[model samples]
Target: MTVDLRDRHVRAVTPAEQSPHSYFVFADGRLLRVGAGSTRCDPIAEVPSIREIGPGTGEGRESELRLYVHGPWVCVTERFGVNAALVNTATGAVRELSRADYHADVSSYSIGFLDRGGRTLLVAQTRWNRLDVFDAASGACLTERIGEVEDIDYFHSLLHVSPDSRHFLSNGWVWAPVDMVRVFTTEAFLTGYEPTSIPVGTAFGYNWDRPCTFVDARTFVLALDDEAAEHPYRQLAFFDVPGEPDERLEPHTLVSCDVFPRNEHGEVKGELHYDPESRHLVALTDGAGAFLVSPAGEVSARLPDLMVGGHGGQAGWSYAPRHRVFFRWNGGSGIEERRIQDCDRAEP
Candidate 1:
């Protein structure tokens, strides 16, 4: 059965922000905040000069600007990690991140807020095979040269820090162009405890840039396509991080579903966001709309159409656990909020 969770609609100047409880839009030197269920788009602050810094070569960058909003904090990073800045929406203070040389392929560089509070920042230098951690608020380099000395062939990209901020997941690819999903202790790596990379599941030559969301501090869900040599299914696989260093990480197929909306080369054409309150993964596919999939792999409900932007203007989808709603921004002048209360009809 298809369940539609359409709730309310709000207007925005730019589809620039996706955080937990609100939508932030940056336009005309101003930052606007839209609460999850409110129609008011309040002008939060006169945003300082946080411009896009880079060669702007437009050679292989994904988008000119990427916004990560967490509570009152905002981090804007160039798509290729050439430059970035951390902004406090409440105070109007800005901290510019250290710049790096541009790399053509986006998989070469990634920048994002590592934890749920937007406190820790991570810039993956895939070209150098190293990860840099930072204190987001104070602009202090917490640690550098992480995974740099490891004798591995993985170009680390697509970082996702767990809810408790204990584990870190990287959906990076390798030379043969295979998508390798890895998990490790976030604290251990930053503190020089477990400097070596821990292995997770690998999907050879399939499911590159697919979506992943953490169910908790120790378990995460990963999307993948069929690859007989590895996880042989177009499904969402749940994997648990080993508690002990000697334990092994394994992928368990919680449910079977199509990993669709793939591009020409069969890459990810969608995103996955988990709502802990409702206990469902919101699968936002580019052209195919959105689906509410349970952890047991059942399609509880679906909204058949979501305005996922064109080309580089892809829609940003996020869930507000406070309101139990999924927000979709299409880089235009409006945002959509869909309530998942109808999902209660699905089995718990």
Candidate 2:
């Protein structure tokens, strides 16, 4: 499939997550739900999901608040040592919860609200080597168990709930520094689990610190380490989730691209975004343009001169599928709209 850059455009403003009828924009300690309350270039009506923090008082440092949204639940939380809540969409009901023991150490980990079937009623917060799932509806502990990483620190680690909701996978090097990645079930986690309760990916890796995700219920994709010493490239691998509980795991290289660039500090300056709609993986960078990678993990197109951090740092871009358009923002520049005729990724 092929993508033409000539059909795209850019803009300058803050980006947001676009739900069907609402535009969810976030700041440090704040979340604004914008919707059909007005008619203009941007969202007119705004609702602060956070109403109160402590004893009817509304005050806190932006640096101390962490914001996230899942389905109709918008979570505005304290960095580590305090409160967390799930904000409802329709009636704006706020469900407050506790994040007291969330071992938010040194920041690569993420917390997600877990849903059973189609209902989201639990919260999953990654702690030391285990994940603590809380009752989002009642602010109670649902369950907890050992995770893939021995030590998932405060910096970059990988944990993604599968789209199919069957499994959740994670990988980090801080703990045992082993090549094996971890996978656990959503049901076992929501229901309950033991210390020795095993999931899958029992022996799933030949590398470390690489990002991976579930391709389906029984298969997944991983970005292996760099290939060249002189010019580094991101090599991707595909592996089948172990069939039997004791089956050995195997991963084969699928594709590679030198899309990862380093900053002056030599740190990776971009983030990889998987577009399920296009079946393409996009590398959005702090330098250069976006490299659209195929499902096979090959770089297919490069749309340069555009500013995007995927959903990194904060919400910087919002894609509206119904409108086939996306908005780009950078805080200073006003919002720009780009039209997408199709993201079919068809070959020219």
Candidate 3:
């Protein structure tokens, strides 16, 4: 299922929750459905308001608009403010979820649908270090962290909910901006959370910010670059999503990648995706190319010549589980699909 979207000039894109073959993309001044195996961009609806607020648009100067899609629901949010909206593509209904106050910043807060069913919404504060869950339908706060901790900010950034919806991981930073990763049990935190009293999940120090994806409900992979070392290298570390909030828990295994090219930022810039059916991890990079990695720290397949683009920030580089293929902008004139081959599958 390969779809060439190089000419589309996508402003924002997110993988459709149910259909791996299709993606919701904002391009050509409208919201359209771009899918695999074909190059046609199907029109969904005219979203003039959404388009105007998106990056590079009139309202985007102050903040960037991000999209999160699951099933029939699309959650739109501003990168720097709490203002958010939930759109139902099925019914063509748009609902304003929250309006921004005045105190939002890079570390303010962000919103996303918490579960696959789109019943819950997750509100995480990047600067204040608070997490809140809300009822998507009623717009009611379901659970929230109470009793704030002064001067101890977790600065939660990219939040990854486990496949089972039992836990979540925050690939965020701390003071002085040290990239740290933390995991938390969803039920425990939501049941009776007190920020000062609760033991937040295990915190891993020095794991610089790259992209990470959950392999399963209890396991995930984190990207690491030994940048300060004499010979810098890229590595992927695998960890069991800790059952308790133990800060000392370390990655059970690590996969060392071949020394490869780097982006202008002096890093192997890319995104990580996991195939649940094949149980494999795929790391796609713009400069160094892509690799098919197993859960057991094995490099099963490597495509070194594949130069990718449109990977970071609001750019979309995603793996569609339904088609078992990776969809990414070629950074040129095409959207390439990299399918995970079964013959290359390695046992973990």
Ranking by TM-score: 1, 3, 2
Identify the leading candidate in terms of lDDT: 1
Candidate 3 has an lDDT of 0.58
Indicate the residue-level lDDT of 75 in model 1.
Answer: 63
lDDT of 3 by residue, 152-266 (tens): 4556655676777877766666666566676677666666442322222333344444567888878787776546456435376777866556644577866776423444444
For model 1 the local lDDT of residue 148 reads 46
RMSD of each: 6.8, 8.8, 5.7
Among all windows of 10 consecutive residues in model 2, the one with the lowest summed lDDT is 3-12
TM-score of 1: 0.75
Which residue runs does candidate 3 get wrong by more than 4 Å? Answer: 1-9, 28-30, 37-65, 79-83, 97-112, 116-128, 144-152, 192-208, 227-234, 259-268, 305-308, 311-317, 329-336, 342-348
Can you write out model 1's per-residue Cα lDDT over 190-285, one digit (the tens) per residue?
A: 766224457674444645456788888888887765445444455777888887773446786556786345566655556787887668787777
**Cα-based lDDT for every prediction:** 0.59, 0.47, 0.58
- Tens-digit per-residue lDDT, 56-110, candidate 2: 1223523234455666566655443345556665456666654334334322334
